[model samples]
Target chain A: MKTRVETVAIIGLGLIGGSLAKALKDNGFCREVIGYGHREPSLRRGLELGVIDSFTLDLDAALSAADIVVICTPTLVAAEILVDILARTEALEQPPVITDGASVKGNLERAARSACKEFPPYLVLGHPIAGSERSGVEAARSDLYVNHRVILTPVAENSSEALALVSDMWAAAGATVVQMTVARHDAVLAATSHLPHVLAYALVDALAESDESDEIFRCAAGGFRDFTRIASSDPVMWRDIAIANKAALLQAIDQFNEHLQQLRRAVVEEDAAGMHETFTRAKQARDEFAAILAEREQAKTS
Target chain B: MKTRVETVAIIGLGLIGGSLAKALKDNGFCREVIGYGHREPSLRRGLELGVIDSFTLDLDAALSAADIVVICTPTLVAAEILVDILARTEALEQPPVITDGASVKGNLERAARSACKEFPPYLVLGHPIAGSERSGVEAARSDLYVNHRVILTPVAENSSEALALVSDMWAAAGATVVQMTVARHDAVLAATSHLPHVLAYALVDALAESDESDEIFRCAAGGFRDFTRIASSDPVMWRDIAIANKAALLQAIDQFNEHLQQLRRAVVEEDAAGMHETFTRAKQARDEFAAILAEREQAKTS
Candidate 1:
């Protein structure tokens, strides 16, 4: 029989942390899920929503008696929290197996390694690839990660048990756990996530500043809404993500620019053949992706 | 007071035509909406679904008896159909004023002017800025144009009665009609509509062709879905639009490429300040657009 983790300490009850708390609570995976937030209002709201059984603002108090601690703060804030946890718990012989739920992993992994010298081999890096445009505890949902991919990038020589625990926790919460190198994670996200946001933001800016701005807005339909919806995302969070994944995002942007130039050329030359090929390829890719997702969904139901 | 036309003719029974037929029928704007489709199956399905009161394959039968004619075929196909109509009705004394429903106006306007020389003063061009990814008569909805924009691009010296009749028809079907020059309409739509579809199709294709195809598919969520939803749109239809609006689309794509390169440079050089400014401007633009939409929606409800 698998041992149940009775207590989980979730630091930072924002969208991610609050979601994890709700998922853990609903699954009956943890008997007590505690939430810690910087502000009193969030802590109270987290409790009120039943995302967490208890709440606190003190990191030491929040971490002292926990079986597992998941830090779900902004990337830089997560790094600072990891350092603070290690500094305070340096004297303890038995510190919790800590993993962070930050989007970017490379920087967080390096910071975690550097701060926790005696590292219980406890630091398992994870990113639950799930979110909403609406933020905070109120927007958190228990099924946010259901059937979603949760990536684990454990450091070399990390304890196998800690890794399994993190993987199993996400599995229990209904995510498909996959393992990859931290660098690969960042690189992949640059194309799939980060770079798209940059493009969406930039496209919105270009159209808004143009002389035909009002006309563009007036004519925008569902397509425009879908393309620019992400621009409504938290600017600060996006800025942090952009800075953290700078290298990979820049590379992705370069590839996109080249492809975009080809489109421009085809358009300028009024090359029907080239335009047909470009849109045809895009249509095929999206259809194939939709097919894969639909297959997975079918398999689960069957 | 606007004349209440008892009979209306709708050519082509696909997504747009079918939806417009249903909208007009549901709103009780006309006694009957006659449809025409070259394909027997589409004609049968449209009639059975009540998307059209009846349909005919005979070209003259479809056009000669109707009071108002709405050409809802593909842009190029619609242009071809306009020529056929003009050739058949050349000897008619009181020909019905023709209005076309195509995305790109300049090309269609030119075609109308050339083909309908005998009925010179009776052509008005319109575009209902509303649609869905799903195609065919099955996807038709009566409320498809609810609170949507319908842009009218009447050529200079066109009859005011013709423009008023077209505008009133759309307004009665629950749309806000706006007027613009054909050149301005094409340029605005190139930025707001065509560029988005092109980029979406291109991005998805680029990712699918890469070795990281499976990983990209797995990581795609709401953002990817939203970004590439239009990529799954009718491929032939998009190809036609891209070709028709090639000039403006090319210019927009070039502008997007320039903006993308600027973003790439900021990321590559780790220019945090520059990145912040870019993101902030994009955010402001998106927010402003959203605010405008919200205001318009509020006005409609109020």
Candidate 2:
């Protein structure tokens, strides 16, 4: 099974990149796993942690040695690095199947399409819906993507073989792979991931800057901590995501704001029935989501 | 220490009430624990579970027998119940030191004041910063308040002995007690707990009402689960809380909306630097809060 890909290169050496390298090695998805990052220290740490078999400074050399390339950098940086990789790989006798682990897909797809004269058929866009508040190579783990959702937004021009390889790589990492258009991927992720991130950050920032900040935080309990847990995520990466998925994110924020306004009105008017209705619906929906997640976990174990 | 109170009466027999009864009995805070509720089944469940030594629907008899009373009903119902208890105990030879576990303090305090020409000095207002999504006597636990914060908001009229008795009871339940004015408690809680609940409910409601709800929830991961965990909380309880803490909640919501608008503007303009700053501050703040909570937990066990 590992012979399908002799070597795999993961760019960025961050949590996702390092985790992917370790998962690939642990699952025997590839014969060797190499890591590349903008920072030499992170690459060194990845090597020290045994997340990768080797580290590469040169993108061209890394691409040349690998059967597949996984871009795991921030969304903005990923776009530029991906474009550069496409350009460098264009002259290769056999270009490797390329994929990314960015949170947003639409902007990356457009950027990739425009960067090359003819969009590469081997470029498969993907975003694994898995991460923790902790970042960098030190926090990477082999089981980070186990039973997580990995969404691939492949363009019409992408080769079936390339898509299959990308899908198989993630599957080997213990992720469940699903495919959709770039638009659909961005929209769904905006609603599920990006919007929640925005809300958490905004809530924390608002409270932190308030007059009663100290007391507010002191009284905050388990629910408050869990609600704002994502606010501790990597800021620069989130910033990039917010910008790259601007349209979908903005739409999500607007919808959320409108719903909040309705709730606020009910609170102000002392409309108990209205508030109860909204909260009941939300509770039912959240419970349903929890049930589905539990079923998925059970299915995976079974 | 157990002789401080001969018999403790818990009103509501729900999660908080049942848990308090169990904790009180487990810690020898009282000779016996008695439960009262509007519903006979819940009171029966409390007695059957041994959270209470006896069950009663007759509040007058329960009040007459108990040395201390803990009100553990919903926010709205708590206000009315506290007032009724005060009125019923007004002519008694010895009134029980009364305290409540309602989330909001201001409304309850006002109701207690208005229900009697002169509020009883034995009445103490409190909010325990502990709960689970689960409800009712079946979900009650003896350790629910262990190492948790319990905020006490005593008015000028509250007797020092009454305050001490209330504080000692919570301490016996393993809670750390803090004192604050009703206004401060309400403001702090609105910023911390109530606003987060509103946001979670609104976010879930928005997504649930959307056409892409199923797909959105399908891809939702750990962050989403934690973010919306409070949305599954009791709808009627939360609705009552929203109305009870309307002013402060509305103010918190407004501030959050302003912060979110700034974030929205940054996203719309692709202001990477602005977004990064806001996200960085939020991350730092959230991390600090988490560290404080960890320290508190460590302190408790040590």
Candidate 3:
């Protein structure tokens, strides 16, 4: 049941919003796309690229006409934007089906529930887990979300039509839609994504300020190059992730710390046998992980 | 000045030895190449691949007619083999210039000085810090050393001719030869290479044996994959490295621990500002590192 979402409003034309605009418009997945950006230059760029049918910073004009509104602001400001939109639009006879493209969901849920108490319910939570280290509207591309996972966490007893429309939207953008609870999503991402970033940051900090920094950096090989590539990602974005997924990210950090301490103990004690066993287990685990990735890749190709 | 060497003996047909054999023979850098591998299959493979002109299990036969002998075994076994070769060929009228292609240099220097006292007057320590994750003679290639660094450490009163010959061999193999003190090399590698391997191994070990392993791994993206790729490297080899460079590696571990503690404190306190600062510094450092790598790549292409 594909509902006709004639005019889709995309708020905050940064990387995610700008990309969505391009992907949906270029693929002919949407009829007319409306865009709202904080900066005038980004709005102009999106318009020049034909990613949006029209653009404005006027929240009322964008929201009143939208059949489907997609919020794509920074993580820290996502809640505020949603609350303001819901509050100001309460007098309207009919409101758009609201969906947010924020990474985290728990805070968004609270903000939405508080602001839209008496209004027609129209809220969907989604996280598109795809990106490049290069960011912003200049880095926008239609194929960024192709073959990536886009997890949607809809509230219980929600409008099935709205959910279907949101699912179709992501599917049209070339993403696989998987549903999960907000808590589960945060924990999984903490272990898989956030922890790696934290460790990479720590490793770089450990080496950069050291005495042999120049020598070690000069001789840094291919292994080091790939391992630290993600450490160059936008810092403020990671800072928000660490705070938003505070509990799970802390658990992940603790787990890695324990592992590191054990390795250090092995080196300190010169326990060759113990160290060898640890390495063997690590090797086996990586092989298994690689196999899983290979299967996913094969599936995509096929 | 290029020095003439009639025969070169490489003991061990694994990645290092087999690669050195191929590079020397393919480029006509040496008159004849002979090898000794612990495994029969590897010896056969090396001969079949033309990495060695001939090979013998008898150690003396491999070393008797050699003008230059390269011991390319694991670091743990490197000392013992160098000692055994010197004892067997101590009575030679004119011993060949001896060099061992080992990662660690202090132990090799001590062993070479102690064992070859009655034998070769020429001893030099060399480390060609270039290789792929793949090991064994099958992975050996003539271009393994191209555009890579080869560090040389010469002891007090070490033969200038021996040092010159070894340097020229590596240079002819397309490596940029650099000289460093043994202690400095160990310290530099400890921070740049050893610590990262330890962190990668620990991170993999933390997840490989857990119940949440499947979920954690499923969500892992490109960053996690690259960071853990080196965790799949040979355990025995890494174990030897951790043991041989214990002191320097321990210092590096301590430094990394301090950084980890800082991150832990920030997370525990929910200090977003602190975490952002740390990540910003790391991002800048990685950018600088990437710039360096890109410059080197550009130089290679041009």
Candidate 4:
């Protein structure tokens, strides 16, 4: 049987939390979806859009009512909030299960570790591998996580019941649940998502500061625009992520720099063979990745 | 009035040449479209697909019957072919107006200058800023250049007749013809197109060579796919571009390296303010670029 919650308290109402609230309510996975945030306009918008049943400024009130609580703030903020949630629910007879939607998992893992000797049973650390460039409650939708992967990095102390409940909620919202170690999650994400964002931001920032900035912007075509799309993502959120996943991101950056040097040497010496081999290897990998995505989509619909 | 040609000889049967052949035929701008290439299968495929009306293995035969000749090959090859075309057509009563679709203009510029005291009046240098990840004659389509910019870099010796004919051909194919100096075109493209391609190729190649490549590959999502889309472009073509646009590209690379160093330092020191400022600037630039695109698209459709 699928697990259901009586109440789900969402600590933030940005895209991830707002979309989850909408998804859970749409699927009837929760009896009441209560939002907790400082922003009044977004909470009111959530209520008007039928994204949440109710909302409060009081974190205690929301946690008191919820059977499950999801912290969905930026990474550093989410880590701090996780600590507060752990402390506030310490004495309760049956405290709410807690999870988060932060991009980086190491900081959350550390926060959870600080509150427990081994690992907190009810603190089910997670990162739903789903989002859009748009943010906040205004952009929330039920199908946001459909056919997407929701990665849950469960600790040793995670209660089976807590894991089941979180998994069922995600499944109800049309997401495929996968498990990973927090360390592995951080490293993989640094290479794939965070690193790409950094390269794009650096490229754009560099070009913007160049002497020929006006001419540079005028000549940017479809490919340049597409490659830099992710650079337009939220700055505060990325800043938080860069800090939260610092070690792994730096490692990825260093690796990329070394390879870039090799490429630069080839270009400088006009090493046609060296450039061809690197490009060929990348093309094969990218093409394979594309095929995998296609197969996964086909599997979902099939 | 639109300029018309009796027979147009495309000296290469790849995407650019094939598409131009298709577009000209589709618009009735030319009486016959003849393809010149060494590959029999591709030339046959071009004929079967109606991308070209006739095929020729002999460059001399193709040049002999043509009112116009487009040397559309990889950059280096295009330069060599330009020299041969100049020599053959040197003794003709009225040499066909020549142009090319090479990405980098310097090589072509040098070739033209070597053959004449000034830029050959009959030779119009051009680069159409339109392409897909797909290439070759089989992937060609008539609408490839529609709504795209075709930049023509005319020299001091370019006759009014040659320049007008080349501009009219591009206009007939649904491209907006723009003019720039050879140096400006190379620099602008190095910053906008070549730099981004190098970064994407480097990122992908670097990740593919990492220890956790399997796990990293598994976690790559839509944004990674979109950012790396251009890395799948033909390696040989890019290699030629890298060598052909060497000086400008190296200058762009050196500039980018400095900015990347600043970003790396910010990340290493955990300078939240620095990271945020850079990301915000990039986001603002990206957003404005997006707005400009939307406006241009709106203007086009309206």
Candidate 5:
């Protein structure tokens, strides 16, 4: 089998970046894995951990030798870096296919379009739906993307060859590639990812500032712990996500607020039947989601 | 060491009830374990599973044979059952010391006081801060309460001896007992447990009814699964809990709404600093809560 990507460049050297480099190296998906980051220590650590064969601080040098580039910086920083990379790679005889691991797509796409006049057809927007509460190169793993969904939102300007290269790269990293429009991707992610993160942070912040904070947390058991687990996620990263996907996230917040208000009314009015109806519906939906995920895992293993 | 109680009766052979029976039987907290339930099948299953040495549908018979009775029914049902038990035990020569595993404490305490002219000093209200998303006797485990917190809210009418007996029983079941007022327990639980359940149910319910329901749920990953795991919990049980602790739960919902609103505004206004601060505070608080729980677990093992 001919490899779709010969040499890959990963920017950021964080969890996603380092993990992708390691997965590519372990799977023999590419001939060389080059890591680039503003942090000298993280770049060195990525080399020490065998996440990359070489390290570079210069974006032009990294882009010059790469067949594909995976941007893994935080959302805001990723947008800025993508613009810089597009400008640097424009002069290359064969500019490497570009993609990113950003959680939000709409803002990044707009920023990319505005940064370059031609808005390179090789730029394929992507997000790998896998991460942990922990961050940085130390938390990266070779199997992080295995069996996980990596959504690709390819624009009209994207060439089919570029899309195939980026998709194949993610497949090589052990992720299942799914394609959708940018709007649909942002809306669905807002509901599933961004909304839940906001709710977790808000719930924990509310409880933390309460008068009985000590007792409240002391008595919090498994359910509370799991429910708020995402509250312990990287704050700056989430802050950027919340800002980047502002419109869709705001709409999600409104919808959730409406549902919560209905529940609050039910509780205040002591409407047991209404409360039961809502809770039962939620359980059914949640159970169906779990069943689907289980089936997917079974399919992957079997 | 001598067993604190020679005979124990568990009413409503559901998750908590069956688990308590198993724990008591395993720890030898009592010589005889009696199970009572309105459902004959669960009662029979309790005995067949060795969760109970005997089974009965007769409340009076079970109460008479018990040295201590642990009521583990839905909040509303538990309140009604407690009243019925208090009424029946009034004429007894020596009534069994009473405790309950109801999630909310205030309403149950009020109902107990109102049920009889002289509220029984033997009644000690408690809630074991342990459970699973699954329910019924089939999900019961002997180690369910191991290293878990059991909050006991003893009113002025509760005798110290009765409190000690109930506390010791839970201790024997591998739980650490903590004391608080009924108001405090209800308030703290509203902030920690009930509010989180409501948010989870509401979030799932909203997404389930959306046009992109399938896509939204299909892409939901580990965070969504864990965050909504409690949404799969028994609906009727949570409904009763929400209604039982209406005032405190409503207040919690309101507080959470305010915090959520703050976050929503930050996103809408593109206030990165405000969102970062909120997420950072939540991360710090959640991490501290996790650290405290880990410390408690370590102390138990060490």
Candidate 6:
């Protein structure tokens, strides 16, 4: 399915929202993209860069004129915004369809349920499996979501029309939309994305503040720096994610900590066989991951 | 100072030794380069790939005919080989100047002290700060060490001539030779190299063995895959490094675990400010690291 709209209002215009606006305009998926935010410089920049057709700080004005609204705030704040959006639209004759680009989906779903007293048929929860350590409208590009996966966790309360429209929008943006439960999405993302980030940040902070910081960093190689690359991601954004997806991320950290302890014990005891087995298993899995990625890349090209 | 030799014996015909052999031969720094290892297939591959001029199964013959020897086995095994080489040549009037590419230095120093009661004058502990996740002689390339740093840990007992000779050898292979104490080398490498490897291996192993592994791996993106790329490195080699650098690595792990637990507490308690502060620090450090690397890269190109 492909989607087109008369106008699209993008709330909280950062990298995610700005990119979506640019992509929508470039694909002619919408006649106009209205950027809604308090960041005057970025909003002005978005208008100047042609990423958005107009800019406004008035939420009501942007929402009333739009056929669709995409909330793109940090995860924790996005839930609050979702609640507010649902409440204010309750009296409308035909409310606009609403979707969000939060990394964690459960909080938004909960907020919607709390506000509406039932699942909001007009509201759909989605997460784009795309981002970078960099942020802001200044970094926006239309191709960010090209060939990326967008996971949509549509609940039973979601109207089929709304779900289809959201899916169509992502498809129009050059993304492959997939469906999953909110629980599954959070858990999988915890292990694959959030957990690695937590570990990387911990490693970087630990090494940087150590007594031998100078020598340690001087000897740090390119691979080691790359391993901690995600530590450079937006701090406030990650903080909200950690709080929003608390339980699953904690479980992920606990599981990884256990595995780390096992390896740590092997090192302490000088148990050569134990360490070798763990290392070999990890190597095999990582190698298989590389092969799968290669196959996926080849399929996309060929 | 630049030095040349009639023959150079590399005691382990793997990626490191083979690359050094090829580089030495390509630079015309030595008349003959010999590979000495028990892995017959890899030794044969080295010969066929022109990575080594010739190879011998007889350690005694190789050592006797060479003016220099480079022990390039895994860190743990390298210690035993060093001890054996030292003992076997104790009676020689002028034994070959010996160097090694073991990632850990303290174990070799301890092994040397235990066997000979003092650090041998002809031995210089060195580690080339270069490698890939891939292994074997077939992966060897002559330019692997070009523009890379190779740290040499030379003790007071090391003869100046022996240290100079080893420095010249690394220089001939296009590596920048830097000197530091053995303890500093182990501690710095523990935090920068060994600790990151341990964490990556643990993350990969934990995710692969979990029940949600299928979904986790399916959702894993390019960045996460590259985050664990070091986990695909040679298992036996990492295992040896873990055992050989046990004390320093354990200290590094303990420090990192403390930072991780602090961050975990912040997440569990929904302490946004605490998490934000830690994340901000980590992000700053990582950003600084990236800038440093970029500056170094610009210097290289300019």
Top candidate on lDDT is 5
Tell me the tens digit of each residue's lDDT in model 4 across A106-203.
Answer: 98888878875556688898888888867889999898888888889988878999998888888999998989998989989999999898988998
**What would the per-residue lDDT of candidate 2 be over residues A30-56, giving only the tens digit for each residue?**
889988877898999888889999998
lDDT of 4 by residue, B1-302 (tens): 66788999999899999999999999989999999988989999999999999998998899888988998888899999999888888777788999999999998899878976556789999999888767899889898888778889998888999999999999989898989999989989998999889988999999888887877877778889889988887888899999999999999888888888898899999999999999999999888888877776776677
Error of 2 at A221 (Å): 1.3
Every candidate's chain B TM-score:
0.92, 0.94, 0.92, 0.93, 0.94, 0.93
Report the lDDT tens digits of candidate 1 across residue range A1-302: 65479789998888888888898888888899988878889989889888899988888988887878999999878888888887877676877778888888887877766876654477788999888877889999888888888999987867898899888889888899999999989988988888889889888878877988877887898789888888877677787888788777877787877777777777777777877877887887888888877876786567
The full ranking of all candidates by DockQ, starting with the best, is 5, 2, 6, 4, 3, 1
In the range B126-164, model 6's lDDT, one tens digit per residue, is 999988756789888888888778999999999999999
- Candidate 2 — number of clashing residue pairs? 0
Candidate 1 lDDT over residue span B129-188, tens digit each: 988767888999987888989999887767898888888889878889999999999999
Error of 4 at B281 (Å): 1.7
> Could you tell me which residue pairs clash in candidate 2?
none
TM-score of chain A, cand. 4: 0.95
Candidate 5 residue-wise lDDT, A236-278, digit = tens: 9899899899999999999999999999889878998999999
Q: Sort the predicted structures by lDDT, highest score first.
A: 5, 2, 4, 6, 3, 1
Write the residue-wise lDDT of candidate 3 on A1-302 in tens digits.
Answer: 44456889999987898788888887777798888867888888888877778998899999988888999987768888888888867667777878878767777776777776642356778888877767777888887777878888877745787788888888988888988887777777787788889989998988888776777788888888877878988899888877777788888888888988999999999999999999999999999999988887777688
RMSD in angstroms, all models? 3.0, 2.4, 2.7, 2.4, 2.0, 2.3
Query: lDDT of each prediction vs. the true structure?
Result: 0.83, 0.90, 0.83, 0.89, 0.91, 0.87
| Interface RMSD, per-candidate values to 1 decimal | 1.5, 0.7, 1.1, 0.9, 0.7, 0.9
lDDT of model 5 at position B262 = 90
lDDT per residue for candidate 2 within B1-302, as digits (tens), equals 34367899998888898888999899888989988888998888778789899978899989988889889988888888887888898887788888899999889878977888886899988999999868889999998998889999988888999999899999999899999999899889988889999999999999999888998999999889999998988898888888899899999899999999999999889998899999999999999999999998898779
- The residue-level lDDT of candidate 1 at A1 comes to 62
Pairs in clash, predicted candidate 5: none
Top candidate when judged by TM-score against the true structure: 5
Q: Report candidate 6's fraction of native contacts.
A: 0.83
Please give the DockQ score of every candidate, comma-separated: 0.61, 0.86, 0.77, 0.79, 0.88, 0.80
Best by DockQ: 5
